[model samples]
Target chain A: MREVFGDFNDGRSAAAHQVAVRLDTNGLNITSEGAGVLQHWPYADLRAIDPPHADAPLRLTSRANPDARLRLGDPAFVEELRRKAPHLFLRGLAQPNVRRNAGIIILTLLVLGLALWQGVPRLSAPLARLIPMQWEQEFGLAFRDRLLAGARTCQSVAGTAALSQLSERLTASLARPPPLTVVVADRATVNAFALPGGHIVILQGLLDKAQSADEVAAVLAHEIGHVRHRHPTQMAIRVAGIGLFADLLTGDGSALAELAGQVGGMLLLLSYSREMERQADAYGRDLLQKAGLSTAALARFFAHLAAEAPTAGGGKLLGYLSSHPPLEERIAVADKDEAGEPALDAAAWQALQNICD
Target chain B: MRQLRVNLTLMDDDSTPSEASAPLRLEQRGRASELLPVVLLNTLLNIVTLSIYRFWGKTKIRQYLWRQTHFMAEPLEYTGTGGELFKGFLVVFFLILLPLAIVGNVANIYLDPENPASLFFPVILYMTIGFLIGFAIYRARRYRLSRTVWRGIRGGMRGSASQYALRSLLFWVSNAITLGWTYPWMQFTLFKRLMTETTFGNRSFQFDGSLKPLYGAFAKFWFGSLFGMLAVALLIWGITFADTAVSTRPDFPFSIAQIAFLLAPLILWIGMAWYKAREINLLASGTTFEGLSFRMDATAWNLVSLIFVNGLITILTLGFGRPFAQLRVFRYVCDRLSITGEVDVAAIQQSSTAVPSMGEGLADAFDLGAV
Candidate 1:
């Protein structure tokens, strides 16, 4: 009988027993040098949980008696067992590390492929939405800060009030409105974006080009649609999930915060998928219809954006439009026959236009 | 105008044989056939998992590399696990990273964007990251050392990571302030610190390299860099002269002057390789583990061709051939490094130093470990 050093596990929760372990033709038999009883583990009932690392300890538990275990102090005994009964010692469990057998490789590929392709895609959206509202709010505010950092804010009191009235009017009609903060930036980029939570940023250039309050309201409604559906939050979740996966892969913890902090920038830069854009558009139409508003205003804004898309020479404009391309298909969808009240009266429209004053 | 290749220590080995006829003997026992499947499987897994399998992938590679590389015909063993690494990463992500992100974002929201004070946020973030990276490298080195086992005796490293980080910070600051002149000093000291801290069972490694001999090489490269800049300027002038004047001549397409001018960058590359090779050689020669002398015989041309050819193949294959590249570098290092004197394995007992609970989390976070 070849002797090996190991720790024996009794049925009770006692201190580990230093024991002399021997593997015979019958099974792995253990004699406790300092403990109360001797145990015999048959090979059929013995199951080994191999150490994840090469130099770590190996644990063997009994299927016959769950509490029975033999913790190998030195894993060299395992190699000896593999040599003795090549079928019994299974840390190679099957093929050793990862390369000796083709079956193990195929199994691993199947499992990981399933986890990534189906798992990530099926889970990213719902998982993202599951994040608490408070976290999403904080996430949105941070992104907004990063976006408007070093840029001038539109601070005209009357124009601000006029803009607030329009936003409140549009959001109040919805069944559930996410907490929204709409601000006009004093930059000349014809764009508007919705951040996670309920933050929206509108460039002064968008305001400057608006022919009427309806056009501006159409743009605002579209942005509000994004917020209402928690698209930004979902987007943030996807990014965070990807960030988490990447960090896990690399074992880098610092990027956790960095990626979290970039949610706002990602929102600004990563264009929503075509399906998401369509969904947002559909949401916008319903919102406008419910608010006694017209889709014609949205169509007109798209028309103007389509025209400006040709002259997309401006650096900021390129950034804005590249992220939110004004598709001809989307413009056509907005050209619905539905009509209702004008977005604002003449004085309110004038005030809204001068919001960046 | 800057090219950044991953900078990593070329691993050295001590074979299992004691009696040596060559004073020092080095050998590589890794078969390309044995490693090819591992690399291919890892590559496949990475693609399927969107690279999430990389931790495990890297672990497998290390395990193979360690097992195949014999010192005196006895292969070293790597004791690290992918699970340990993954757990460490998850802990850092949850405990340190996520909370920090939330706080940072909230803080940025309150900061005045128009104020110059806000610029400090990014600078502070970058600096903090740098510091963390230094700390991470220290810890990762400790983990790697602690996991290295030869003939049942484990190699270990123990020192304060923050102290290492501080020393590294000082070196980096000095390097910056001196316009890169302090690099050799910084590298030597840093390497010395690492070696001095390293322990194998009961023995300790010593790095006795001085900064003086290294300066000649550093100065040579520094002055060579200046000359390279001047040559580049002249080359541009020549190119412009050729563009304007040489087009008129149909028969003189191949001029000796232009050909020599075009080779200036190659000359600079050669100088850079020479400087690097010299520093590495000096470092290897200066290091001793338990009274054993180390040998390194690498040349500028050897490194230049290896890196250049490896790079060309990697780029051409679009990274599919990375396993071969990795294998080639390992073969190169194994072939070039040798050790004198014999290790008494029977004298060294197994160290009871409990393995570190985690692996290279912060290093992974900082992206400090190239491999």
Candidate 2:
């Protein structure tokens, strides 16, 4: 008596064996012997066997008849096989094909390449649209006008003479005048921004926060570093790529807003690569020291900003912090070396603070 | 031995035709047993190659998992090789990553076109490509493992590449159409179809309709996201209210609201921990096969509590909470889970001794017990 279980493509050879016993992994297989003799037995018959085999016995294959097989005699083997077979089968099925795996890898790389190819052009389109060389001249003129207007505003806020005197001192200090103008904005946001073609905007709020003129100078010096490095142009180009990508994908003019939003988000979240930040910090510090301003004020300003009330909308504050090193860390680095005299006298500090009011 | 004569008598003339099927079964040990050595070897390789082995290590794990479970017959066999797959993936990935890297470098150079240092763009491009390709290979291998491991038994898993691609496309389309509500259903259907189609030896595969576990996983994920959002909102609200309340008095430098704001993240962390615990417990307990039943000995709540407590401690203690988490999960599976048959953890561990420590750590973390 033999049992065969499962679907075997090759089964005919098993029938040829005399006194053949076949065991199926799941059941039994039997054939008919005519003339009042029971031939084929079903899988259910195993249940009746004394100390019944829970699983079919292992089948040993014959070389001459590829399909012909015999069951192992040990009943224990059947029990153990039944106990573990499911897991074993699962494990076998789970194994990855080397060729298929390799194929998938290659396919994925191809997809990635395709995505980049598709994505980059979309990213670059806005930059291409904006960079016609004419925009530089237009940008420079617009920047000059804004700087002049800002200077007038500063004069109105601070006494004219004080403003004039400050400007004259700044101009005299520059041996090779940079191709840019700096004017203080009346706004109370503690921000400093650089315009294309060397125009720098310093907010009154930033000036009020600086305890000393050197801190104000530190801010200006950082802007100067940006102007010198052409950081604005680089930033514009980077943003333009993002904008282009958005515009291409959406095919909507409103995507310009999305682009701006993305750029703003990026500016807040992305720190200047460590080397870039270090270079800017070094340049600003060098500028302040040469101008006879103490660099310690920069460290003081960082500490002050860090201690400020965490901004409303955690997103904004998180955004700001993401792009900059931890304030305490930056402060520590600045305080490592103390050099030069305080750039602001008591009167100058008072005047700078009062500019916003 | 006595040759016992059994009566060979035909019961009746009406004999049912035997089903022509040859179902071959092979035992599969848990992934943890196989994963440990590969992980360890890769970690060691990583040290020797300055992180290059990180990519190779990832590929190796996928390959190892695939090989461990593969069976051509009753005695399982594996046809895939990690080295070959890794190399193939790397080559293809580099071809793609290199160009994008070039673009990044070119953009960097264009920031200052006249500088001679800009010529280093090609070198930067190549290095970036190499790194991305390595990472991509790792990702690819992982995907392959997850897909192959639960293959069904009938018709040997049918679906052409185009069909798969279409299915993936429809997955996204349906998600968009149904506003993400259909995601779980889609996932279930896809998984069931994939599992049922894969055939080996003779038996076909089938997934027991166990949507309860899946629903539990989804609920945990949803709750976790909700908690995280709530924490962020609370922080914002607290900060705003404090600013308003304190703005009138310049002398009031600090406010209670500020304290509330700071503690919001802690609350969010707890929520996340809870979610993770719930999710893991549901997934571990929910999975079952046809004609086979599985039961986790540990209560779901107990597992969840263990994870939450350990995770919180880890978070507060700068990542020292991992060992406790691992121990808890191990204890739960070893002492709690039972299949109707025998399981020997010690013996399984012994067989996996060739695996490295980090590999073992990962395997332990995932709780892939030996079969």
Candidate 3:
């Protein structure tokens, strides 16, 4: 029988250690002489040689400088060893052959394909439904309703037709009007929600806090961008589909309710895609310029909001700005524009700021 | 390959009697065997209750199996109250049954007339309505079950109820278009999505879509059925021919003919079973996990024989053979299919330690035990 041995550990050992060697022969009585001192070792005490075979019996002999002599009289041991040699060699060779990251890319592609197959067609109709032709009118009506409600609740209103007309003219000049309906809430929580179905609710506190009309318009335009893209609906569908898919695959519907409850909250904090935000910004600037308003007003407004609340806890409004470019970056973009015109004439600016009243 | 002969000689003098000592008894404990009885009993209880005790029985079965099969001795505790399941089932049942009953009643009253033209439309309408209701209930129950379990894990469920309803509708529509053959594949896809989304103690379960076993089973069923039909046909033909020949020629003895006729069926049946057993062995022989491996027992043929005999008896006795068939199949699968190699209670306990929560771990252990 052919026997091969390789050092299991790197050669740093100082002491001689007796190693257990196992040999299988076909009914062969094999005896060894001059193999150095023999030690009695139980089969169980033998160190596992990677893959252990139960049928193999191992024996321990001395590790000394000696010429070992082996006598094989019994034919059984020799035959058994010959028979098992091939399998042993194959196993030894297979130990080091490992595949790295072979499945990851394939699996990722498969998942992506499946997602698109399930999600794309379902997304089209809702996307189409989001864009509205009369966004300014809708926003006007919603704002008026909120103002009326605030008036009933003993909150002061600074309602003016000139402000609504200016907003209308500004939106009409845009390539694509923002779909969000503006609702001014009476509370001063400095929060706004781009709700599902083009409903944008802005707190009066936020309006009151704004130093310029451009700042308020910037916020409104961002929310309008969210509505136009139907982000909330998309997020809702994605979350629901993910939950359903998970349940179907694992047959474990374990945390589905928690997922459901988080959907609305997550939507409220929804981030629009970067492309959508960029498109909205470009559209808003173009609309302001066409309406004879200075593009720098948008920059000035952000500067005021940033300075007034240096450490604005953005958690509540993060979703509204999720898809938009960073505020500082957008402020820079607005500042680069040198349109020689006032953002709003004094009367329009005053009227716009008090429209929530 | 040369067959190897291993010689184990009993050496005397300066040695202990190793050969006389019972062959190294490898004690195996905490195996799935321990949990089998629990699962079987639970299944029996579930059957007895007409599935009313399904949730509780399943929970108990899972707990027992997990505890017994896992390396750890963790106990699984149910945090979910039975009331949730009860309420869920009630809602599901009413949702499905009420609409169907109302439609059936309406059809019986309005369209059951000697009016033949009204029959087609009402029947179709009733079926459509019934389908819708069944689909709704199924979705609702699914949602409820998922939500309830998720709540148990302290995670918020985030999905619209309407979306779930729509998904249910879409699933049915797709399934209907594909007929029922796509059912298994759809189920697999759906299951994969669901499990991937769920997390427990930060680790998520993954679905491995290995359909080899199912395909193997299907192949066996088809071949077995074909062989069985052929065998029965041959037996019938042989018996009739032999009887006719014996009657026609007095020189050809009746006893010989009768013996041949009887032997024909027996031989055919035995051959069929032998083929089945061999197929089962081919499919199951090398299943291994961790350090444990299994070999299909040859006794599967004997089980098949017993099942055939019982089935025959049942048919002969006009449907009275069901209990015997059930008992035999159960006993055979249990006794013949077993695992071997390095499967100890300690290993099971050790394997379970990595599970997140004790309860969930135990549940997993039970599932393993059942497997």
Give me the candidate number with maximum DockQ.
1
Q: Which candidate has the top score in TM-score?
A: 1
User: For each candidate, what's the DockQ?
Assistant: 0.11, 0.03, 0.01
Q: TM-score: which is higher, 2 or 3?
A: 2
What tens digits encode model 1's per-residue C-alpha lDDT throughout A269-298?
254443466677777777788888887787
Kindly list the per-residue Cα lDDT of model 3 for residues A193-244, writing each as its tens digit.
Answer: 5654566666766767777666566566556655666654455445545443
Instruction: State the lDDT at B337 in candidate 2.
Output: 50
Residue A274 CA displacement from its true place in model 2, Å: 9.0
Stretches of candidate 3 off by over 4 Å are A1-163, A174-180, A237-272, A313-324, A339-357, B1-371
lDDT tens digits by residue: candidate 2, A1-357? 333222211222112122323445553344323323223333432221111223533443333332223334456445544453332222222534434543554564465445434543344334434544345435654655655464433644453344444444444466775566666668777878766567777778787776667677777777677666655555555454444333222221122334444664365325532334555677777777666667777777867765675452124456455544555556777867676776656766666666545
Better of 1 and 3 by DockQ: 1
Displacement of residue A314 (Cα, Å) in model 1 is 28
TM-score of each: 0.64, 0.36, 0.35
What lDDT score goes with residue B130 in model 1?
69
Q: Which of the CAPRI classes, incorrect, acceptable, medium or high, describes model 1?
A: incorrect
Comparing candidate 1 with candidate 2, which one achieves the higher lDDT? Answer: 1
Q: Which structure is stronger by TM-score: 1 or 3?
A: 1
TM-score of chain A of each: 0.60, 0.51, 0.51
TM-score-sorted candidate list, best first: 1, 2, 3
